[model samples]
Target: MKLLNLQRRMARAVMTPLTHSERMRTVAPDGRSMRAVASQIIKPNDRLTSFERLEIYNRQYWFRVLSAFAEDFPGVRAVLGGRRFDAMAKAYLIDCPSQSFTLRNLGSRLVSWLQKHPSRAGERQNLAVDMARLEWADIEAFDGLREPSLKPEDLAGVNPAKLRLRSQPYISLLALRYPVDDLLLEVRKDSDDLDVASNAFNERHKRKRVGAVAKLNPSAIFLAVHRLDEDVYFRRLDREEFAILSALQAGKPLSAAIESALRGSLIAVADRAAHVEKWFHTWAALGWFCRLEKSPKNEKAASRQ
Candidate 1:
């Protein structure tokens, strides 16, 4: 084989997902022999055979990839416990190997993957999905791109009827079936406390404390995850507020977004009008909207005026 082709084959061999024992099997179910493959490509070191050398890279590759994935989804790990989380992480890696240049993208498909394989998630499937969503939102909120925020003066002459709002690219809207934000916060708190106490204490006591954190409770939740002052925050929103913001994020004009918000049964007709201005002011101060863009129809109407 050509050197470049040989290199490619060796890379695939090391990256092929398999246990150490499976790696030694001859003509295994997958129709590839690690021993035969290694002999063809790798030369033995003084003490290590070609297969032994290849095995080192294989184990290390999986360990590093799995570690990065676990770091990104710490809340999921906490929810699923160590053993199950490890198994699921291994399976997930095999199914959705690292295709992106950046490890941050590793969890991009995790939420959908979990949904498709709910049986692997055991009884807390929905909760696992929620946690994954929340964590991914946080990741995006922290590193996602953003346009310049609209300042208060930028709205000076804007007409509410025709004002189309653009959401900050960093803003993420999520409607979850569980209070995963609260659960994540509690889990993080326990983790922080454990780290602090670990230095002065024993392992058994630390494990007990970690086990004592509050259990997750299911609740309908609407959340806006966004960045403010270089920090990511999770804000709980009313259903009506979420509806309005989501519509605005979807590129609806202010008038239409209000209409969408009012469509929710939770907000009374009388209360809707009163809340519109208040919500707008709160959103503006929070830097949720990037800038107001005049719709073409509105521009034409104003031109005729």
Candidate 2:
């Protein structure tokens, strides 16, 4: 075989999702004995056979990928417990192998994957999905690209009807079916406490610690996940406020976004007009919007002034 073809074959073998013992079988389900294949391609060392040497690479690859995946979704792991989380992670990796160079992208499809394969999560599927979404959003907010923010003063002269505001690139607007932010925060707190306590305990008296999975009642939750400086925060939004932000994120102009917000039953018709100024003030103060999106005509008109 050509050198490049040989390299690709080795990569495929190493990345193929299988246990070491399964790969060592004489006649595997794939019809080719992995041991036979390994012997044909690999040069065995003094201490190990071709299959044993190949298994070393396979184990290391999986261990590193799974470790990074677990680190990225600790909340999901907490919700599912160790055994189930391990199974789910293995299944997810088989289906959605790492396409990106960075380990950070490992759990990118986790939410949707959990939704489709709810059986993998057993009874805690919804909770798992919600936690995955929140955790993934936190990851995005922490490292996602940043856009220049518009100051509160930037909107002073702009007409609300023609003004289109762009959301900050790092900001994420999520409408979840459960109050998962609270659950995740609590789980993380408990995990941190356990870590501290474990360090101080004598080895003979140390016990295995598991996170308490709480029963959370389902409720519609609107959240804004964004970063301020180096810290990420989860801000709960009222229904009306969420509608407005969702609309703006979808490229609606300020007037239309406000109309969308007011159409929701959360805000009374009389109160919407009165609240518009206050909402914009709060959103601007939070640095939610990056800039006003101006049309070519508006740009030309402003240039002539």
User: What's the lDDT for residue 185 in model 1?
Assistant: 79
lDDT of each: 0.79, 0.78
Model 1 pairs in collision? none
lDDT of 1: 0.79
Q: Write the per-residue lDDT of candidate 2 for residues 217-246, one digit (tens) a residue.
A: 667889999988768999998888888889
